[model samples]
Structures are given as C-alpha cells and as structure tokens.
Target: MTCPLIQKDLANACALETVKKIVAEIGDGIFCVLVDESGDCSNKEHMVVVVRFIDGRGFVVERFIRIVHVPNISATGLKKALETLLSGLGLCISKIRGQGYDGASNMRGHLGCLKTLIKKREPQAYYVHCFAHQPLLALVSIARNHEDVDWFFCEINRLVTFIRSFNKRQDLLCKKQVSHFADLIENELMETGTWLNQELSIARANDTLWGSYFRILTRLVWLFTPIVELLEDLNSD
Candidate 1:
C-alpha cells in the first residue's frame, strides 16, 4: 500500500477484470459504439471509446472500454486508432450496428470521413450524430440569432461569477437558504421527508453542455429570495 507502483498495478488489474466481465456479458452480441476525441489539460489529444449493448436482463448498458492517445485527429488516423483499440479488446469492427460521433468535419464529413471509412468496412454500422450535442447546438444557434436570449445568458453568467468570487457570499447564501427553509417548514408551507428539501448551491454553466445552463437557471429560480438578499447585503456593505 505504501508503494505507488503497486497501487497502479492493482488498479490496472481491477480495470482489466472489469473489461473481461463486460466482454463475457456481451457474448458475441452486436453493439453500438460511441467515439469522441478531446484535448486534455496538458493539450494531449485522447480518444474515448464506449460500447452500448443489451444485457442478459434486456436492459440497455453502456461501458467505457478505453481511452487511447491519438497524436492525429485526421480521418485515417482516428480510424486506425479505433481499429487497434477494438482489436486489442478482442472485439470485431464488423459486429458494430451503430456509430455515434459528434458533428465534427473529420468525423462526419461527406468524403474520406471517419464514418465513411467505417462504412466501407462495415456497411451496417449506421452513423448517428451524438444526441447529447443536439441541445447544445440548438442553444448555440438561438443565442447567436436572438439578442434578448444572448443578453440574458450573459447577465446570468455575470451574476453567478460575482456571487461565487467570494467565500463569504457563498456561506451567506447557504445560511439564508437554511433560514428560509426553516420558516417554510414551521408554517407547514413545505413538507419534510426523507431526501426532501435538499440543500442547493449555484451551478456554473458550461459552453458545451445544455444541462448545465438548465441547472443554473433552475437553481436561480429556486433560490431567488436568498440570492436577492445576498445582493442587497453586498450593496449595503
């Protein structure tokens, strides 16, 4: 336990065992693959591969199979990296029933794209743009075309940043929420139960995720009174 190398070896062993179990569950069944590449904090490109298939209980399951370093993001480079990863895992590319990738030019381009290259090998591997990105793309388009929506988002961003800049302000917000909830509970305006009226904090929005935007807006509405009180106190100070 005191040795770092030993710890790393143990972790690797656990990971390999988990992958082996997942492969046994798959049992030569067709699976859909989702592949995406992004740069790490050190500016190194890495590609993640996930496999989706139905389990013995007939429930849809998705497992992260590997994250391989890809020095190149070109169509051919990505395809080669993918093939190597799948083959190493003892998986056949021909068994792929679906391919999911983000709407990147190198991925879904009309000619000489990753999808095109994969199709040449396995015609049944139908390509679908990642659904998680659809709402993000829609929100981005709306923000560009509409002035009011874009301005609202900007103001929200400023408000969240201002509040989160100071540790004292965050503590004040949490204290105010506690007091407000107490009042509601005493007056029977709110019900108390297991997992009810959980504590909430401000969520920062992300440029690539629509769910983060929704969360911040929802928290803003839920904690409106405490937020307003916080701003008023700051103004007085």
Candidate 2:
C-alpha cells in the first residue's frame, strides 16, 4: 500500500512536522539576534549569526546557528546570504524581535544597503547599537581630538610594552604589587579596554577634572619610572 514516491514524501513531511512541533513547543517569545562579519587573513568575509532567546525550558540561551563565508560585502551579497540562511533553516523573519551589530556602516546605515533590505522585509525588527562598543568609540574620538590626551595613551602603551617585553621589568612590577601584581593589573586594566570610547576623554581632562585619573596615573608613574629613566639614559648615550 506504499508507493516509493509517497513513502519518500511522507518521510520528508514527518521531518518538517518534527521541526514544527519543536517550534511550537518553544512558543511565542522575543528573540535577540547578533550578527557580525569579518574578513580572515585570506580576505574572505565570513558572516556569523547567533540567536538568543528563552527556550522551551524558560532558560535564556544563545545559540550560534550559522557561519557563512561570503566573497564580498555588497548589499546584494549580504541580502542573499541572509535569505539563504533563513530559508535553509526554516526560520521566519517575522519572529525576529531584536537586532544587534557592532555599528558597521553596512549594518546600520539608512541607505548603505543591508539595513534597507532588512527593513523592507521586516519593518518591525528593532535595532540596538552595541553599548559596549559605543563607549569605546567615544574614547577613541576623545583621544584623537586632544594632543595631551593622546600623549597619555602613548605613555601608557610605552609603559605596558616595557613591562611586557622584559622579564626583569615584569618581575619588578610584580614585586611592587600590594596584592598579587597579576590580579591587580587584571582588575584595573583588563576590562578597561572594553570602554575604549572613554579613553581619550579620561586622558585629556585635567587631574582635577577626574580624581580617579590621578590614582591610575600615579600607579603608572610609580611602576614605570625606572624603565622610563633607563630608556632615556640609553637614548642620551
């Protein structure tokens, strides 16, 4: 009673049915998407798309669904890649509630293409600029605009480079630590770079403007004077 074509069709139908069951179980909820594109050393741009949502069990989870390699960054290419990804995965665009990007012009531009294409299809897709990245951008702008502030960053980099370059300098830094030197540095500097947008602003404003800068600068001056003096002596010689 089973025709081969009918049997094959039934198998495919069951597969889709299973997918539908899962989606239904997941129910209605807002889903957040993060998309980024980057070029490798080979100059191939790869787009990665991830989804975050409350799953059937009511736990928030982020799942990476696709990493697609694209040859170019044109609007047409990006649109096609997205459409193909959604169609292949049986994902509905209407279900998308939030979109996030790293402020790439192509991703957020009013007419630069990608945003235009997406808005045409899913007008309700709300876009949010990555807040962490925005802070870094603000810092970069402040640094570039002020000369003294720029000098501060250069100095900080020089100091960091000196310590990182030689074991002796690193040991000296470790010895001067009130607690574990590594822990101190990690606590103060590791997450600092994530706020790159405010870096220049923090550097330029006078010591009186932000009292915290003095504390940070004092630490740098204490830890780095020996290395700086040595370098100066070498230059003079």
Please, what is the whole-model Cα lDDT of each candidate in the order they appear?
0.90, 0.64
Lowest-scoring 10 consecutive residues by lDDT in candidate 2?
197-206
lDDT of 2 at 32: 66
Q: Evaluate model 1: give its TM-score.
A: 0.63
**Runs off by more than 4 Å, candidate 2:** 1-30, 141-147, 151-237
TM-score of each: 0.63, 0.49
Q: How many residue pairs clash (N, CA or C atoms closer than 3 angstroms) in each of the candidate models, in the order given?
A: 0, 6
| Candidate 2 vs. true structure, TM-score | 0.49
Model 1: per-residue lDDT, tens digit, 26-140?
A: 8789999999998999999999999999999999999998789999999999999999988888888889999999878888888999999999999999998898888788778
RMSD of each: 9.0, 13.4
Give candidate 1's whole-model lDDT.
Answer: 0.90
Off by over 4 Å in 1: 148-237
* Candidate 2 structure quality by residue, lDDT tens digits, 60-166: 87766667898777767877887787666666767777777765668777685676677677888777876656766676777668999878766765655655677
Q: CA lDDT of 66 in candidate 2? A: 64
Clashing pairs in 2: 135-197, 136-196, 136-197, 138-197, 139-197, 139-198
